[model samples]
Target chain A: MRRGLILLGALLALAACQQTPAPRQALFVVLPGDDGHIGAITVNDGKREILLDRPYAASESRGGVTAPVQTSEVEVRQVFGAALAARPILPVHFRLYFQTGSDRLTPESDAAYRAVFDDIRRRPVYQVEVVGHTDTTGVAARNQDLSQQRAASMRDRLVRDGIAAGAITTAGRGELDQAVPTARGVDEPRNRRVEVTVR
Target chain B: MHKFVWAGVATLALAGLAGPAMAAGAVIGQVKTVAGQAFVLRDGGRVAARPGDAVQEKDVLETGADGAIGVTFIDNSVFSSGPNSQVSLEEFSFDSSNFKGAMTSEVRRGTLTVVSGDIARSTPGSMKVKTPTAIMGVRGTTFAVQVKP
Candidate 1:
């Protein structure tokens, strides 16, 4: 009876020790300030660090060493806080230009698209949520279609550039979700934009 | 003689009209993946399949209105169909011990992405997606299929 009791106690102790605590995985968003500068950000310990280096000058090619501007720490706690607050540091906005009543992308938007592509390419594993919007200058139905097409075009470009298409989700908000509210006939440059969130 | 011939001609025309009305096909399932649009019905429930579903030879599949579906074959390969697409499974068969079969699908419209799975690697040329414009045969890679209506 004594042996049995001791064995039972040992088994209970082992069970208690074997129990594993769940991992702490939290989502965070990097919110850029109005000046396009990211404030303090948080990330998990195991999460990979993002290196932000300044663009190399043409003369820097001759030198073997390139100076980095700064390094930011991404902590899990901050990530959790931001996720709770529903904001991100690097918020992307695309101003897609069209030939007046068409969904086709114009050449003027190419440079802007390249910038977006470069941002995505810099971080491969990041998932993106794309919301397309348009100015209220056109018919409601037409605006809806145009916005969707614009979002799709951006998605295709990203996919072609070797980004996983699955990681990106696209939605056309039409003129319903406007950045800058304007009258029906007014042209709102900010409204004709696509917002991309990388988290 | 002339009256009898006219009656026979009218009967044949009526049969033709009735045949088309009775030949309507049913919507078996829906597409639930990105850029994919094919699905199959099993046990009265829509199987939003990944590439891992065990398939036998001659399984009939169809796409939902969105024209996107996901499938995982026995070998764990994933594929998805886009919206407004339709694909009929021409053939499928697999066994864990012996993984070998052929799968042919017809994409009537929309887009599809085939991510090479185990089946494509083990038995090359066994998987083929036929579009209205061309037939896509998988070697072992990710490729998209788009058919314009």
Candidate 2:
């Protein structure tokens, strides 16, 4: 019985020695708004000091709306690290407002778009999808057209900045797909936005 | 005698006007194939069509409206057209009858996709889709057409 106990203890030690540690992954999150209000970005990774508080300048207007300036490559890497650590790198959807029936980027969204551009540029193997959506206000047909135009405009901007055009696919879901639902004739600010996904 | 002659003339004019009106032509089919507007009939026939062409029976047809419409063909091909798209099916046909036919269509503007079925395969090279800038030939498969006007 003592020999058996010693054997069992030895087996346990061997098993413990063979155990592997989980991989170290990182995650970062940033929320930028149109009202010149840039939300706090947090990065959680051991051995890496990411400055998430960098201020992105506001730049040219899209569809008569000023979009926030583009984010740098360093910031994008931090965010990508965070996203990869949290989950499978599926596309994340965010809202960007535009002028009604126009493809111009708003001032607030410029910075976010820049960040997105930076992120896509850093990852060459990844593909980007830009889907535009609109609230239910006008005719469904017109809404679909407008939404598509907006999505295409955004895609053009990305391509101009050096991303391969083939890697991007733009779709206008129209009012048929809504991120936020509201009453009829009610213009929801959140609803009139573009959703971008990096896959 | 003069009044009698005038009444007969009026009757003849009325008959001529009513004859054609009763059988007004409809867009039988439209060209939605590839590279150009073309359609094939069920009996293994084909036609070349262009954008803004009227869709009629006996003509393979497709359409794009400001709204949505569900389209089905004799060969069981289904297609959906989004708003503001210009679509037309120009040809349609079955191959079990000896594989002799052609289909064609055109997209002036907008977006559309075809969910090709047995008909597309049975009739290879028989399907053609035309956009404003390019002509697409289908090799027994499904594809999409988007034209920016």
- TM-scores of the candidates in the order shown: 0.33, 0.34
Superposition error at A6 for model 1 (Å): 48
Q: Chain A TM-score per model, please list them.
A: 0.51, 0.54
The runs of at least 3 residues in candidate 1 whose Cα sits more than 4 Å from the true structure, single-residue gaps closed, are A1-99, A106-108, B1-149
C-alpha lDDT of residue A127 in model 2: 55
Q: Per-residue lDDT tens digits of candidate 2, residues A12-115?
A: 99987897433211112232322344433222122232233333321212222222345544643332222212111222345678866567777888777878
- At residue B121, give the lDDT of candidate 2: 56
Candidate 1 residue lDDT tens string, A85-151: 2111222445565555555556777666777777766642345657677888879998998888877
Q: Ten consecutive residues with minimal summed lDDT in candidate 2 chain A? A: A81-90
